[model samples]
Each structure stands twice: as structure tokens, then as C-alpha cells.
Target: MEQDVFRLHYEATQARVEEALREQIGRMGRYADLREAMEYSLMAGGKRIRPVLVLESCRMCGGDPETALPFACAVEMIHTYSLIHDDLPAMDDDELRRGRPTNHMVYGEATAILAGDGLLTAAFQALTQADLTAQQRVDAVACLSLAAGPEGMVGGQAMDMAGEGRSLTRSELEQLQSLKTGALIAAAAELGCIAAGGSPEQREAVRRYAQCLGRAFQVQDDILDVTSTDEELGKPTGSDREKEKNTFVSLLGLERSRELVEELTAQAVAALDGFSSRDFLVWLANTLAQRTK
Candidate 1:
């Protein structure tokens, strides 16, 4: 039963994301080359998990998924932008992403950089154009800005760069991962609340749930990097170890990290206890913790 819900949400959200990507890309008039490059990277395969979170959260709050689609796409664009930049030659220096050549590898460094920039700007544009109440728009914009801004994803990236090749306390590592990875996930949930006109208390509940899920998601990713193959992960595995980056799996044993993931998953599900529409969210949280990729 839970698997059915997961599969349904996953497939439905995937289709929505693809449609949004096509529509968004089509609007990029002129500068056709840059637009193509941007679309290439954006359309590159991903699980579309962030956008799905946005839609699911809105659905759980008794909102229309159609109304939430723009914000959902916006979050995905931001996530894709981060990935493009993260794979840059001066950054992670990754040669592959989503089982294909990195943006820089195919489009050149300058083009890749521009592609990332375009996607970031486009995300805000998409959010601003969402068909929502003025207040909802304002809140959604604020949530997205905070998640993508210096206090969140960018700050986290800075910390990650600083911590590379250095030892970090478990707390410090968690903090960095929370900001870098968890912020966007939390924003997904928060935007859903805004779109649904949820009360502050309800939004807070969803935020907490997403935060726990995001932490567990990142830790599981770390574990997969050590244990899964590149094909299975859709990117290079063991890259963290190769770069000597501190990860949960590096600081804690694999068994310990797995245990932590299960604990976090429980906390995430527990956060949704009072919500009336929680079945899909619960299933998503559990599936994320246990996924091979």
C-alpha cells in the first residue's frame, strides 16, 4: 500500500517536472545556445525529489497540485543550478552528473557557469509568476530566497569548501549538511504551506518534517557513495572519500550511519503524526531513507 502511494506520487511528480521544464525552457527566447545548454542540464535525469516534496506537502495541506506546480518547478531549478555549479571544474571537479557528462564537459566552463546563473534567475522568475495570492507569493519568494541565499545553500557550500581535507566535528558536519542540503528541502515544505494557505503552526510542522527528512536523505547519500556503484547512483561513487571530504559515513561507521538514517526517518514521520493527510509523506520519508540511490 505504501509502495503504491510512493510510486504514484513519484510518477505524477516526474511528469509534472518534465512538463514544467519544457514550458520554462521554451520561454527562453533568443540566446538560443545558452537556453539549449541550460535546458540540457535541467532536463538531465534526476529523481525530482525536491519538487515532489513541494507538491506532496501542498497536497497534504488540502491544496491543488496545479496551483503548487510553479513553486515546485522553481525549487527543482534551484536544485539543478546547485548541481551545475557543484560540478564545475573549480568546485567538485566532477566529470559526470546524472549518468552523463558534466555541464562544463559538454558546454564549456563559461557556458556552464552561465547556464547555472540562468537557472538560478529563472527559478525566482518562475516563483514570482506563480498563480497564487499576493501574500502567498510573497511568502514563497521569501522562503525560496532564504533557502538559496547566503544564510542557507550558499553558506553551506562555503562551509563545505572550507571543511574539505580537514577534520570536522560531527555537529559541525551536520550543521553544514543541514544548511547546504536541508534548507531547500525545508523550503519545499514551507512553500507548500504558503500555497495552501496553511496556518503558521501547520507550516512549522511540515518544516520540521522536511528538515528531518533532508538530514536523513543526505546521510543516506553519504552511505550510498561508499557502498553503491556509480551506475546505481547516477554519478561517481566514492568521490567523497577520494576528495577526503568529511561525511557521516566517514565519521561514523557504515552501520552507525544506517542506524542514524533510520532514527531520522522515524523523527521525520513522527513530525507528520497530527496531519490528517500523512500517508504519502510517511511513505516518502521511509523510501528516501532506504533507497539505493
Candidate 2:
């Protein structure tokens, strides 16, 4: 398929996921202030890649997107919550995200923290409400819980914090990226498999694909930080340098980083060979490898 066709598919899926997100958020309990803050960041414009991955992975498994919408929204909520907390004064301390003020910058530290907390817990609620079988829901919940828990994303974050202002070896950086970013991406793909009642072999294949794609995603992000403008990125540029962080770009330079992305993209695409209808997933990996933002 042409790039234009893939772009259209991505846009359409993104819109659908956005609507699902709004509906899920609307069902939240009445806590005006907390809800407002939560909505502020949750509704903030993003690529919605995680949710798209969920929907697309389900499609790849011959499952219905409607059946996957709940899990898709849940992953996005978790992602949005992570971004809110990551932008706090104590974290990256950025004042901008998705071309607007950071959640804490606009809503205050307390509300921002609460908003992140709300979204985090809401993710589980969203999972519980997914339209899957009892056993499927149980498996999906367990998968997501492991990915978001202390041993996964949280642990990766802790390592990231510990490595701040210090140069890390390539292996250490890869380990951090695998947990902090790759874990959730892996879960998104895994959730799609679980939601679709995919066979164990299919589940493992997408997991491998997501692992490579997730690392590529982060590598591209690092590329964008230096190469993309704040307008394109919707956030401050050169932040990695400003924070003195060890990113793929910083460690490998532009040329080498691009090579790494290509390598990972190929690996991700190859992992999809176990499936018959994987054009979208393949195109997505290549597109992400070359994305500016």
C-alpha cells in the first residue's frame, strides 16, 4: 500500500480511539476538579500510537476493533497519566507538552498529581469494563498490571532517574528503554492478542514485534528531540541535551541512530511474518522509524 493509504488508515483509527477515550473519560465519577485536570491532559492531542497499536494488533489477529476499544482506551489513559507525571516539576520539569502548558504548569502540582493518579486507576477500571470473556479479562488485566507495575514501567522510571546527569553504557540505556517504553508497548500488543483470543504463537510473535517497534519508537523520539522543532514536536526541543540525558542520539549520533532505527524497523516488520494480513503493521513500523515527531 502507498504511504497515503497508510496515513489515512492511521488517521481514521486515531479518531476512533479518541472518541472511545472521550466516552470512557465521560463515565468517570463526579469529582469536578480532578476530572477537569484529568480531561485536560487525557484530551491533549497526541499521536495516539499506543491505542492504534492495540486496535491494529487486534485487527491483525482477525479480531474486531470494537471489541478492543476498551483496552485501547485504557492504554492511552495509562500513557497520558505517565506523561502528566513525567512533566511535573520533580520529573522532566517541562512547561510544554503537545504544544500546550504541562499539566502541572496549568493545573498546579497537587491537581496534576491527582490527575495522574486518577488516570492510572481509571486504566484498571477501563480494563474491567472491556467486552471480553471472564477469563480473557482476567488475563488482560494481569498482563496490563505487570506492564504498569513496579517491576516494569515504574522500575524503568526509577532507573532513568538514577541515571540522570550521568552517562550510561549502551546496554544500560537499552535496558532502561526496554522497561520504561517497551514494556507498555509490549502490553498494548499483548492486550490486542488477548482481546482477540489469539493463539499462544500469535501472541509471542506480536510481542517480539512490539519489543522492536517500541525501542524504535524511543529512538525516533530521541531523533526528533534534536532534529524537530518545538512546533513539530509540540514540546520543547533539545530537552535531552538540556537534561543531560543519555539517549540513542546522544550515544550514537544522528547517522548511527538512524541506522539503529532502520535495524529495529526491519526486525519489527519481520516479526509480523507469522500473520497473513500485516500490511498496516509493517507500514506502521517503517513510518514510525522515519517519523519526525
Q: Name the regions of candidate 1 deviating beyond 4 angstroms.
A: none
Candidate 1 lDDT over residue span 141-182, tens digit each: 899999999999999999999899999999999999999999
Cα lDDT for residue 121, candidate 1: 95
State the RMSD for candidate 2.
1.0
TM-score of every model versus the real structure? 0.98, 0.98
| lDDT, candidate 2, 112-200, per-residue tens | 99999999999988988987998988888899889987888888998999999999999999999999989999999999988999999
lDDT of each: 0.91, 0.91
lDDT of 2: 0.91
Q: What is the lDDT of residue 230 in candidate 2?
A: 87
What lDDT does candidate 1 reach at residue 14? 89
